[model samples]
Target: MAYRIAARHPGRLVTYTAETEEAALAKWEELAADGVPFEMTDADGVRVDDIDLEDRIDARGDGDA
Candidate 1:
């Protein structure tokens, strides 16, 4: 399944798509690292919870994943 990441800047919306969930999460982390606020959608284009996603990333970063 494909995953998508969308970020809204001052006046533009940027998006990125990945062929797999892993890649998508990696892309999310990349964006987060850049300090850009973004939202992620599943294959169906349904937005996931930003808080949950951030928690997961934090867990991974803490070596608890």
Candidate 2:
């Protein structure tokens, strides 16, 4: 699973995927700091604006452990 970061500007939707919530949040914060507005969501398509970081981390599959 991956974290999805999407930025909507005018007529475009820019997106990126991150392997971990930390990395995803980092990128999100980076974008915000740089004045890029965006929304964050998890692999399950849940909005993460009010979600806990740990809870947003994707669980590994049986063979991915």
Candidate 3:
């Protein structure tokens, strides 16, 4: 499974994948390790092009660590 990213900002994060959660996590950790921007919504609820990571996370950092 290919996981998508959703960054709350240019170099921030919010959430990640559950289906691709396992592998996607590696990328998330990698980005976070380097302070890169990224996030991901429930692929079921949103699409790649439609995901506004910054807006979503800004609205609710519900999945930040």
- Per lDDT, the best of the predicted structures is 2
Worst 10 residues of 3 by lDDT: 48-57
TM-score order of candidates, best first? 2, 1, 3
**Candidate 2 lDDT tens digits, 1-65:** 58888987568888989888778878877887887789888889987762466554434334463
How far in Å is the alpha carbon of 40 misplaced in model 3?
1.5
- Residue 8's lDDT within candidate 2 is 72
Which residue pairs in candidate 3 collide? Answer: 6-39, 7-39, 8-54
- The residue-by-residue lDDT of candidate 3 on 1-65, one tens digit each, is 34567656555455645454445555566777886655544556555322343344446546565
Better of 1 and 2 by lDDT: 2
Model 3, position 22, has a per-residue lDDT of 47
TM-score of each: 0.63, 0.66, 0.41
Off by over 4 Å in 1: 49-65
**Better by lDDT, candidate 3 or 1:** 1
Residue pairs of candidate 1 with colliding backbone atoms:
none
Model 2 TM-score on a 0 to 1 scale: 0.66
- Residue 64 local lDDT, model 2: 62
Of the two candidates 1 and 2, the one with more favorable TM-score, higher being better, is: 2
lDDT of 1 by residue, 1-65 (tens): 67788887668999888775557767777887888889888777777654555554566685655
Error of 3 at 57 (Å): 22
